[model samples]
Target: MAAATFIEYSKGTQFVSTHIYGSWWFCMLWGALAIGTITYIIKMRMHSATLLLLHTSFIVILTGALITHLFAIKGLVHIRKGITTNQYIVNNGKEIKTLPFNIRLNNFNIIYNNGTSAPKDYISYITITDDKQSKDGYISINNIFTYNFVRLYQTSYDDDGNGTYLTINSDPYGIAISYTGYALLFFSLIWLLIDPNGSYRKLLKSPLLKKGMLCIMFLCGFSSVTQAASTLPDISANKFGKLDIMYNNRICPIQTFAIDFTEKLYGSSSYNDYSAEQVLTGFIFWNDEWKNEPIIKIKDNTLRKYFGLPKYISINQLFDKNLGGYILGPAVQEYYQGNHDKLHKAIIEIDDKVQLIMSLRHGEPFKIFPYGKGDNIIWYSPKAQVPKSMDTDKAMFVKNIFTLLNQSAHSGNYNQFNSLIAKIRIYQEQNGGNTLPSVTQVIAELTYNRIPFANILFMINITMGFITLLYSIYRLTSIKNNRHITKIISYTSIIIMLLSFIALTYCEILRWIISKNIPMANGYETMLLLAWFVMLFSLIFYHRFKILITFGFLMSGFFLLVSHIGQMDPQITPIMPVLSSPLLSIHVSIIMMSFALLSLTFICGLTALILYVTHRIKHDEKTIIDNQLSSLYLLSKILLYPAMSALGIGIFVGAIWANISWGQYWSWDPKEVWALITFMFYAIVLHKKSLPVFNSPLYYHIYTTVAFAMILMTYFGVNYFLGGMHSYA
Candidate 1:
């Protein structure tokens, strides 16, 4: 599957689906697995209902997939408004399928958010005419319409909104069977956790485990300045930031725009001693002075040299006096023309920043005044073109607010400046009406922006976690331990981590409330959620496995760090229409939590490897080293059960979501294939009897530690290298 992503062998022929997944060998492999599982269960007389059901669920799911591959009819239907259609195109237009009924598109509407042009939903109203009767139905992104075993899902629409494209699927039997398997799998996992005789429970009951747990508890004790100051009044700038504006197709405070803008150009939310608002305000009012401040970050040394610019190039420097044009214009044109090698890609990035600064200078991005009415309302900056429908006086006011505000700031007329800000707010309220966010939501978002909780928490977590890890290691290796000191350090570290967790939780909640959606829509948001999950699971199991506390802090810190990586944008934006489903939230949450648990398992494996190496070097007591290794191995096993189960359930839930939104349960996208691979590889560790190698603690630890690469590949590699349908996640 991984190889299929890179090698486009037999390009555009459905090579992967036909030659790999749908091949006879693939069916034979699944058949062999089913037979092997049943034979093993019978030969061993395995009477555990939870275990039997869990294994059976996988077989049933595969059976359903095979059924779908063999019999499902998937196609696309495009219906123009007021037109009836019963035929659909399939197989990249190589085949046509006729529906038993006709579907007439009554109307197609692109629903926008209350005050913004961002589409909230795409609704296609249609009348289905069958032989017996006719029925009216509506289909949206996640809302599917079903009739006579055929499902219809909204896929795309004509730009003019005269027609819509919908996906059609007639796979009743396969979907039913797959969904049944998903349900069984979910229930069996829940039962396995509570089952008194389950391996997880039995392991907890073992005497050696109890003794090892006590020993673990005992050992727990161990552990930019360069930019010139903006001359703008900080107070007024901040006050201006409170006023609402339309940004990224949503209504938000100007502060949100400023922070995003500043971070994009300067690589931080603030420059020198000025806040983001002050810096941005300065740029709008004092473009000549601000443009030459050399604040824009240019990280590529080669690009900087080619342009003969410093590490931080000013806006003015990007325009060459000798060339009489933008320095990057030629390269940027090449980039647009599809010359996207390493250097051109970097040029495009710098070009984006340059373009953003230019936009800010023209006041194009500062859409602060609401105009028009109802769903047609548009926010206009001082420099934006005014619509003819707008009242002449209102349009003039919208175009001159920034000019007046700039004059007021220059004159240092505090009262006038304050009144201008207030007037803008009032104008927004009058025009934006209920579509605008409530005052509380705006305040919450402002608060979220100011705190920088993720930034602070990552630093605190990494530093404190590393300290605790060192102390824990000391306690582990030391023959004579200071119990009093260890307890104090352990308790202190836990308290700090507890506080950080609470802060992170508050951050996520604030983000959720502000965005009006769950904070798991993109890579940055999911990483933040993953960090939260790691801390949550760590705290839950801290007592039984004290080492988890250290792992939790470290993992959470690393997750936050990843969220801050260059490619991951930390800005909070509205989710796409397809992501509005409640199922998506549940799916992402479960997947991230499972990832957190798997991360902990990796930490356990790493710790065991370290212990083995340390014990060998020191020639430590055989019994003592073995006991430690045994405890670590047990912890990994305990984590594996839920991690593997949750991953499996999460993948299936995503499939169901896909079926709802895209009219197909599985498309064998890169992310889906890699997720399946990760699940299967980890599942091998659970079958200790069949894979005797895993029965050995040393080999088990090594295998698990190495297996973590699959998780990394699934989560990070698929996202960065192998583009897929789920890349938005």
Candidate 2:
């Protein structure tokens, strides 16, 4: 697999590597090993029939794969609309292979999400014809059609929609056997999960697990909060709200609109000093103090130059004070509240008869007919498509905006503009034929508001957890007895983590309510979920295994801090079409859960390492620290199999989803490669106990800690550096 990955990366595309990997020797070696394992399990572990069946499936899969490699015919076929082809290029264009039947492309069209340009799906209408029979069918990324032991998979397309490309695979015998093996493997996994040997089944019986489950249930019980609507501010009243009208392929709330506009305009959704919500409301409502807030923080010198500013400027200085004139020229007057006595607005000077400057609101004003001269000029739609039928509404909207500007310019009283803005919004809403944005706006406000409840809870957990940890350490080291106080402090920190988890989970729920999509679609949301899962694991296993409460709080706090980064801002944006899969949600959630479990083990491993180092340095006999180290080591060992199992299942499930979405089960995409690496690394960690060198608790802790590097690569490294299909993060 490693060699195949290298070849794919260096050579580009997996065609050559696939042929090399499909070699007979490679297939037979794996098949032999699988067969040997199945035989050993059956003969030695007579009582473990389930285990035997599971091992036997591996041989079945290998045998099927070997057969497929030996006999399968695969190539790419590109058929232009209104054109038919029966031959496909094969072996890196070295030759062409003629199919048994002619393939005709009827039409190829891309499906986009409603109201947004994001592609929802790709489909190719096709017809298959032979001398004796003809069939009409279509193929999509996730949907395939099979005829006579041959399969057609939607693969790629030309820049324009005129041509459709598909992968044609003909494997007469091996696919059925492989599918049978896959079915058995899935059933075996399900059986193992429900059987007594399953870690989850045994853990479910523990009181701590029951308590954890109860807390989750109690936290999620009141779901009605998501249903309430109609409380958010008027959509039309907020210019920023109207600016970003589309989200998730539909018209979103004004709050979402406002944040998206600012996020793109300022290149940041929020700041440490001012939340995205505050900046949005402040800008929309035209609150003097809020507008004066230094929300538009500029770090780039080039941006500073672009804005015609010194090193930095506040939102008020740049926009509210009409300082935008320095950069935007005359059009700045439209956005300005008439704060300055003179306007240095820039003009477009079209034909020297008409001078115009664009407004930053939505870009390109409407061009009104009978173009008037000077400041009295009327602008109609830029696209020259303004409906003549609704002239009254258009006139009213323009009239209200002009009135508001006049009031700001002369009387310096902008309060009446609010009512005018509301009227304008109503007219705009009617024109656009959209539903009320109040529900989505309210949810966005709740989510992006300053120092959100989730953040506050995390802060409390971090502070309290640190204090408790310090106090507990003191009690452990000192001769004096302070057991009662330590116990109180420790439990308090645990309670704080519980509160944090609940708060974060509620935020996720609210997001689901408003966006109507699973919140695990992005890095920020996934990290938040990861933190919640970490807390869940700590709570469930803490009492039984003396899992470190302090570690949970610290790790959760760190995760929240990462989530708080401006780039990772939890802004509700539209998700890609490929992400709109039930399997995607399950894949990401499972991967996150596995990472969370591994993170807990990481904490244990680190604690054990620290104690081991301390004992070695002090040359002391076994004491409290030594006993604690042993407990942490035992806890890590106990968790190893569950974490490994989760990682394995998640990686495989993701492959299944990829097969559905990309038409190839294994793409060797960078993220997929790293995930496979992570799985293999964890597998080694889990089985290392069999080796004498790694049998010691010290070596086990060290290996577990070191193995976490692969997890980091799978999550962060693949996301930020080794970009690929999974680069949505």
The TM-score that candidate 1 achieves is 0.96
lDDT of each: 0.84, 0.60
Which tens-of-lDDT digit does each residue in 386-473 have in candidate 1? 8888888888788777789889877878689889888888888888866688877988898998897877888998888788877776
Worst ten-residue run, lDDT, model 2? 216-225
RMSD (CA, Å), each prediction: 2.1, 10.0
lDDT at residue 261 of model 1 (Cα atoms) = 84
Model 2: per-residue Cα lDDT over 1-729, one tens digit each:
545555655565555355655566766767777777767665665565555566666677667767766777888898999899999988878899899999889999897544445566789998899999999999986688887877888888898889988988786567667667766666665665567865446545655344453222111111011211111133323442443244434445445644554554355555443444445544433434444444344544553565466542443454344543434445444536554332212221110111211132332332212123332222243234444554665655553564364354244344554555455556444444323345565556445542364556557766755664555444444456544565566566667667777777777777776566888887878888888887788777666543456667767776776666535755565676567889888888888888888877776677677656755676657765555555555566656656666676677678668656654555557777778778767766544423565556677788888888877777776677555667656
Question: Which candidate number has the best lDDT?
Answer: 1
